[model samples]
Target: MKINKFLLGAFALSVGFASCSNEEPIKGDNGGATDGEKYVTVRINSVGDIGSRAATDNDDFEGPAEGSSEGNVTKENIRFYFFTADGMPFVMSQTGVNGTVNTNMVKPDALNVSNTNGDEKTSLEAVLVLGAPEKYVGNRPAIMFCVANATDEAAFEQFAKKRLDAIPDIEVNTPGEWSKFRMTSSTYKEGEGEGAKVIYYTDISDNVKDTKDAAMANPANIYLERLAAKMRVKGLGEYTVMEKNEDGTLATAQYKIRDENGTTITALKVNLLGWEPYMTANSCYAVKNIDKTWTNTSLFNGWNNADLHRCYWALAPGIVSPNNNTIPLYDNNKFKYGNYDGNKPTENIVYTYENTSYQPASVTDRSTKATAILVKAVVKLEGSDEGIDMVEWGSDYFTLEYFKAIVVEAYNADKDVTNQATAKDVVLKKNTGADARSNTWYATVKGDDFKRFSNISWWQNGITSYFVNVEHLGSKYGVVRNHIYDYTFNNVVGLGVPGDDPVNPQDPKPSYLAARVHVLNWHVVSNSTILQ
Candidate 1:
């Protein structure tokens, strides 16, 4: 895909050379030129298939019938040739069969042999101009003839006159007896695959006659006629490009089908080309329901369902991250508050115990849900970067904002508390708290309330340390240690009923819900005194 500058130049040069060589020869003015100096250019017109049928078992009658079975009909081998006014014999060139000949550098035996083979050889009429090296100017008429053996002479002559006669025309006895020929006119582009050959035939003209005898008398005319016949064959069988009557839409053309008589049957008003667009529109409508479902249900909720995830997983690999955290376990037996010695604790004492129990709350699923929503939003925004925005705010800033949003969402969802905040907030706090001691902090939440503070830096930082410790502690001890701190008496305290009763009894709420409950032990203690 990456083309070097030098190679590109070389390719361009090669293309130019090929283009120059492929250009069709233009006829020059030959006024008053001598017969020896005359020149002409001839080109191929068309090609087509010719064949005969043989009887086979498929056409046989089941019971004993009078007629024999007919075999499947197929086209025979195709032939191609060119038609031109130039008298020169057909010579295969790099571009195509050319008819122009160099009279000045004539070969020893030029035009010396007769074309009376009547089978293989053919000839054509060419303009004759007489001229010496410096005096060549005008052109004159020259007789056209072809050499073919006994078997092909008659057919070849007939073909030549039908094509080269002053008024080119043909006559058809029956519709099925139409003569076919190939027609090609367009110039080939450089580096393209081999040139295409078009086949067509002249429709019958009532006035034209089948002069087989006259064509045979003049053999050169036969060659010209055959060449013209080859050029007129239509290769793209029976095609039409129709325009819609109502709105100018392009309609498909009709195609030729075989009739019972084993002849090509041309159908009128057929619409073959329109089928593709019709099928495409139908398929879109068929899938309308699936698209509606995705639009109606929020994309975030749909993604969370395991089934939806599996579907997406099959469609696009590596979409879901591999490192999702497992759900935390909760303890049902642990007491929220410390046990008292009194047989019946006073109201104040009970209230105090209740308030203390609410110090720490358990983690909730809502936190995970919110984080999942944030991640989904980030991904969605990222996906829309390629779309056009109509708003005046301009697309560049929105593109930058999209990137910023991803980073912000990811940082906020981190278990570490320090990194949790909008970019603006992080910048302001960093500036204001420059003098304060800075250290890598960690956090662990005991109750469901962990969801609310999941975005905080302290928790995210703490999770990292906990993860590292668990890995170093190995499976046997890691699980036991996690059980103790992850679900203990202190951790489960604040997860119960509200301790404080609101003045409005209906709004019963916890008075002192504990934000977090975990040991804050750190291996690398910061030296705050040394910094001061």
Candidate 2:
């Protein structure tokens, strides 16, 4: 039994390629090519054309090595799907050992190929022996789709089992069915615990040739893409950090915003809690698809270079709200806290399916809202103790105790000598007929009816949040697969949304957070927003 060997190279860069350990012999009665069969060599490329976009502030996380059996781009198994020249599905006859071979796939022998030119490295290859009926020899398969790490028919919506003994067929020409095929966890059976697998697939319709000799000489190239995007939060430089002591031990953490000269703001402080993905999509198509009417196409200036398999925008499931709204305290899967070290980026990163909003007219529009990072933090005023919680009213911020004193003074000014009130007499105004949720602080004197007066209780617990919408290359706002979003907070000025609500969080009124976002190759994209 002889195994044909070839080479599969990494993407445009010298990384993210998968290699097989040993060649599995092609098992069949006919050891080699039969009368109607041909040999087609394919060089699968792992993630191609991640652009040369530079990071403005922080570096991206390192991708996994090709030889390693882990990471996002690793290919444990690969399968091929064929379509005739006329767009008809081509089903291969089950050859090899009956129970061992799937008609749609062939396990290739792994051979590492090193490029002498140093343009690329750690290549993988697979040689396929394609058999066809003698009658259809001249008009064999013309289009090929390569998929990696999708072995289980029970796992993917694209490979959902319709009957036993064989995988169901797909309508190659049916755009609706093809676009609906996804690699996601939403299709798993109840309690299957079979989380969504990181699957990669590519279309090589343009690479196929008419004859076997032509294909052998010019092996078809496939650039596999994972149907998800990655994001990381990093902080650049150091800050004037202030530690709050409780019982003579440091209990709370805070940082003072400084000017360009490193002069600290002594009156105000901020305590960064963590960040979570807002409006993140749970699923993406196995093969990315784009809308023909995507007018923001101009924004993809250096994007969608097929030669390098790099794309900037993709159509993803639209999400109006966050899947989870629980305010995370410590570190968890959904939320990650930044432990600043004044040297490197904090270990705050996440992976999510592409989430896009088509040419959103305004950021506040819920129907076309883009995916964002919800950064949670506590804004406080420097005090004798740890810090003092503040409340927002009208146009200014007042400490909780100070705001209470103003409310008590207002009540006394509105009353006679016998009707004067104190701090304990003030309470939140109650909602009544036709009135919305009372956003006012009310005065309830000894026997006087409660009177609604001023704004208060907006900043509950002194916690605030800011939403930083992820952006693509050009004019649009979105997250695309195989790209990295690195966001670093340079400085947080003023106060953000009072009482940060994970869902429906409002933009900061007077203050804002200055942050820089870099998306890497994972084509890296850089976005800088200065909040005032």
Instruction: Name the regions of candidate 1 deviating beyond 4 angstroms.
Output: 1-36, 45-151, 159-167, 172-532
Each candidate's TM vs. the true structure?
0.13, 0.66
Q: In order, what is each prediction's RMSD in angstroms?
A: 37.8, 11.5
Clashing pairs in 2: 8-124, 23-109, 27-96, 49-308, 299-474, 519-524, 519-525, 520-523, 520-524, 521-524
lDDT of 1: 0.17
The sequence of per-residue lDDT tens digits that candidate 1 reaches over residues 132-215 is 212222122122222111112232233332232321232211112112211111111112125421112111111111232222
lDDT of 2 by residue, 82-146 (tens): 55554455544444221222443333333333343365444453333443323332345555555
